[model samples]
Target: MGSTSPPATAKCSSDWFAHKKKNGRISRCPIWGDIGEKQNAVDFEHSFLRAMRASNIEKKDFILEFQLYLTHGSPANDWYIAAAAAASDWDAFAAAFWVKFPAPKVQVRMPMEYEWILTELRLDEAKLLEHHPDTNNYMWKCNEQANWKDFTNTIKAVKKQEIEEGVEHQKLLEKTKAEVAAVQKGLWECIPPMPETPSKALGHSLAGMGFADNSRGRYGRDQRGGYAGRGNYRGRGGGPGQRNSTPLTSEKVATLAWNVALLPHHPNTSEGLQAYWEQLAAWAGRWGREAVINHEKPVLLKPGMSPVASGECFNCGMRGHQGQFCEAMGDQTLGFREREWRVLCGHNLPHSSGHSAQVNNVLDDDFDTWLSGGLGKGEGSTD
Candidate 1:
């Protein structure tokens, strides 16, 4: 009789029945079975409470079912009735439920407003119920008067300050713009006007005479003959009787030198030279009577071997002498002698060849006149 069935076949049938019974445990329970299979005592309690709170179940019905589950280890029939008694709005129960149970899901649903309740009550619910006896009462009061008047006032004050700062910034920008405009206006008024254009007739005349360009007209060989063959000279020019000559002291030399240094680079004639000398004589008189003066020497005029000669006369329409000589020889037809003199002195002229003789004659005569007055008669003459 014991050998009537196979041992392997009987064992497999018993194991299958055991597995089926174990899987059916959650579905057998009424409270958890509605959502899914019941997991354990702790998990069942958490799910039941969440459903109740979300439904805003009345407090009395919640307590009744809560007690039943705590004491009997199972949810009662009509659990939704208990949920309705606990709260008016299911959302409001989220914070209250978290404070009591503090599960992860409940924590997520809890409102941030609960922080005020925690701060005012100063309670850590996890520590112990005894430590946070007044937490519930504090939360109830906070809920009743939840107006943010003080916070709104602080925000308004900050906004007003920002507006005032913006106004001041605009005013500063305007002030800076006005100051810049005034400075620009002053600069415009202070600037000098540009020089006028040269006349076309003057330009054409200069161009025809090969004196139009500065490079062509410039005298290459020191026309004054004063610094010829001299090495590069810096500093001021010197005066008469101040060079390496007899009976000239260094103090007297320096006094004369200072005066001559102020004279123009090229004096057209001997009269211009004599005028400079007179000024130097006055300086020397003052210097000789004053404290020990350091005198500089006069720069010597270098003599060129070229014999001084005159060109064709534009005044007399002749080919040998200048206009001054023409005038001296009783020729009044040369009427542009003064204008020619200005040109010979390096003053810019409108006509070049037309005034060459007249210019040269005026310079030569002026030089002779000045020499006769200064060295010959001791009467300082000016051209």
Candidate 2:
């Protein structure tokens, strides 16, 4: 008779089982117990079954093989052995081994909602969402780990800090307001009229006063274009002096002086106007003594009355000058000292917006001559 053939599934030889057998247990068999990875257990099961089939091990012997491979130290290992012993067929045994080890259950954790976090924190959802954190982890911690206790504690701490800052700021503001009130008390009558309305007009009034405190421009120029000093006025050009110079006649000087003196007499004069005249008086006290004396003379231009002795620049109405000449004729930078005199003295002179004094027409010839000879394309033009 021919030798019996091995089963088609039999791949392992008796020699392989001989190597696996050591003493009583299968020594070289893979252990299934304590497998951390589910895939590892599955892979071991596949290979172990294939080896058993190839070796042509009987069903009863398969249990012994499982006992050797699925050894101690695992709950699943114990269950797998019992499953293998009770299994009636190969398919049942295979199912038992696999049931003990399945792919680790996939754990899905949902992210916390941003709106829920904002609600828990008692923050404005609209505002907080608009801001961003430096890292996703930090933001996650804020959203996930922050509890009601933490939220309440943070709110209390922030409120305390804000209150302290507000108190300090209010104290400073009150002190400033008090000091301002004191300063304003003395100038109550002098302060220009405050607007009747308390909204935009009040803001403008406060701002205007602030401007006056900071610089000369606020008080220096009036709505009517009156300036207290020499620099700003482009004087009515042309006279007996430099044709470019706005020289005042005897009549114009008298008129201007009266207007200035009567400004303080007006019904509702502004503080700036009052202050301007006060400042001018102070200046005159220091420099106008001799000019005052010369002014008393009946004829300012008459011979033998030294213009220098008069103590004022009659050409510009500034102190310390002779009537024969004025610095204003060529220099535009002479400050508005002469203008103060002109405004105070008053005149029917044309407004700044209107045409220049008609006197310029008559002085055209004199102006041309002076421009050709005196003011060359030279020194003063550079400015």
Largest lDDT belongs to which candidate? 2
Candidate 1 lDDT over residue span 1-383, tens digit each: 23322245432243432332344311222233223433344465566566446445455444433433332333333433455366565454434433434333333536667876678787444332222222321222222222445434544656777989989999999888678656755665676643456554343222223122232233223445332322111101100001122433556544554533443433537665555445444433333323232223222111111011112233332233223223322222222422122222221211234322221211222554556557635465444
lDDT of 1 at 39: 37
Angstrom error of the Cα, residue 326, model 1: value is 55
Quick one: best TM-score, which candidate? Answer: 2
How close to the true structure is residue 104 of candidate 2, measured as C-alpha lDDT?
56
Q: List the candidates' TM-scores in order.
A: 0.13, 0.20
- Lowest lDDT 10-residue stretch of candidate 2: 208-217
